[model samples]
Target: MAFTGIPFAALDFYEDLEADNSKVWWNAHKDVYDRSVKAPMAALAAVLEPEFGQAKLFRPYRDVRFSKDKTPYKAHQGAFVARGPSLGYYVQIDPAGLFVAGGFYGATTEGIARFREAVDTEVRGTELEGIVAAMQEAGFDIGGDQLKTKPRGYEADHPRIDLLRHKTLTVSRHFGSPPWLETPDAAVQVRDAWRNMAPLVEWAEQVLQ
Candidate 1:
């Protein structure tokens, strides 16, 4: 089926789930989830696949083996579009709203080493700084874990100290629960946000390569 849009019921489903996160409640409302939540997400993924590459929807079951909270199902639905193991675009839909993000959320050991090396180089480092600055100016939030102090080998007074301290790098934009979310415009908004972050995504891909 062609992508229409996410219905209001999807958001409503999440809100209800948050209030009653039990198997009984979920089983009763499974149809609502299938029609409103999962179906629309599949459609959204289908629509984005051509440009963003293959879409992979995450399973709703949470791995509670190592965690404290044992919530059976996730409160939100998320998906990623990628060509291979490389990071690409991501999307999330929940009660809060829609979130679109790109870039390496966390890199492999080799990827992290390459990323730091790129930041240590003058030309590539400056280019990354510009990309991040522009993304911030465009209203996207920069995200990732960072070291409180300088990294092991990096000096505290290093020029790209901030970038060098980052363990992972990513950019994301959030849209509050807007009326457009119930319509096809939600996909359009996500697409535009992804497009805006393309330069940063490309930069990361190049550096990691």
Candidate 2:
């Protein structure tokens, strides 16, 4: 797939990243960053629009101290598709996903607990369940290792034991897609994941709009 038509402006984020890493390879090849990331993402986004609506490009940033091979920049690009709800997915251009993460988190303990509660209570039976089940089936865990903690007012054996157990799917860009499916499996996986998240998206849209 080619990003033959994706405007260069949509991927202007790379130039900033290059400026930030002026002493590294990123500054030297600012022009190719899109070819490596934004372009692939554009290709995927084009194919996903019919099923997922318009996908927006997310800027790439360099995590200067993130790893041993930290090159002062990320080689892949990402974006969220918001047809009915907001959902995120990324495309890797480099040998990455050495570190990849996604999930819902609150700025404080109370907010986190409330988010967990909302998932278990109000949103349990809706699309969220499908998201959780699909993620689990895909071999990713949500909420990280914090799932073991109990809410401040909850008991150890509360029915919401598994109730408050909201989780997110984590996929390494390195892993080859599982069997079945045509096209890049990442988009398909994300679509199935989004299916269960439409309701929540709709709710948020109502509040924001």
Candidate 3:
């Protein structure tokens, strides 16, 4: 199917789900979920696969067995394209709006060690610094999990200590309820963000994956 746009009703569905995350609510409105939320998301992912590779739409059901919150359904609908072991591109439609992101998420311990080593090396480290700097300059928010303290061998004042402490890395941006999100231009916006993130994703794939 050709990519179109996320309907405004999709966002409304998620907002209502937040208030009533029970089987009764889901059963009553499943057609709306299928039509407004899942179909549009699948269409969007289908169009993105040519350049970014196949995308996986996350299932809405939440795994509550190990969690305390126990919400039955996810509050958002997200899609991911796994470019490498722990590296990927992602998009989502939520109550707030569309979110686009890409990078390494939950890379293995050994991979994180290699990431730190690469950051500790001046030649390679400066390349990453430049990538992050440019993304920030372009208004993307750089984020990831980090250690509270140093990564053992690195000095407290290392040039890229901040980058060195990352256990997982990602770059993301949110386009909050923009007019484009409710039209076919939504695909263009998502494509642009993913392309912008290619450098960072490629770097992590080489170093961490």
Which of candidates 1 and 3 reaches a greater lDDT? 3
Estimate, for each residue in 1-209, the C-alpha lDDT of model 3 and write its tens digit: 66679988999999999999999999999999999899999999988889999999999999999999988999999999998886899999889988999998887779988999999999889999999999999999999999998889889999899998899989999998988787899999999999999999998988875
User: Candidate 2 — which residues are off by over 4 angstroms?
Assistant: 1-24, 63-71, 82-93, 97-114, 119-131, 143-148, 162-174, 177-209
Candidate 1 per-residue lDDT, tens place, 1-86, comes to 76677887888899999999889999999999989888989989888777777789998778889999988989999999862245
Q: For residue 17, give model 1's deviation from the true position in Å.
A: 0.7
Per-residue C-alpha lDDT of model 2 across residues 37-104, encoded as one tens digit per residue? 55656776787678657767766566657567655555446565643222233333233221222333
Candidate 2 accuracy as lDDT: 0.47
Give candidates' CA RMSD values in order.
1.4, 7.3, 0.9
Q: How many steric clashes between backbone atoms does each model show?
A: 0, 4, 0
Best by TM-score: 3
| C-alpha local distance difference test of each model | 0.86, 0.47, 0.92
Q: Which residue pairs in candidate 1 have backbone atoms (N, alpha carbon, C) closer than 3 angstroms, thus clashing?
A: none
Better of 1 and 2 by TM-score: 1
The TM-score values for the models, in the order shown, are: 0.94, 0.54, 0.97
- For candidate 2, what is the TM-score? 0.54
Q: After superposition, how far is residue 39 of candidate 3 from its true place, in Å?
A: 0.7
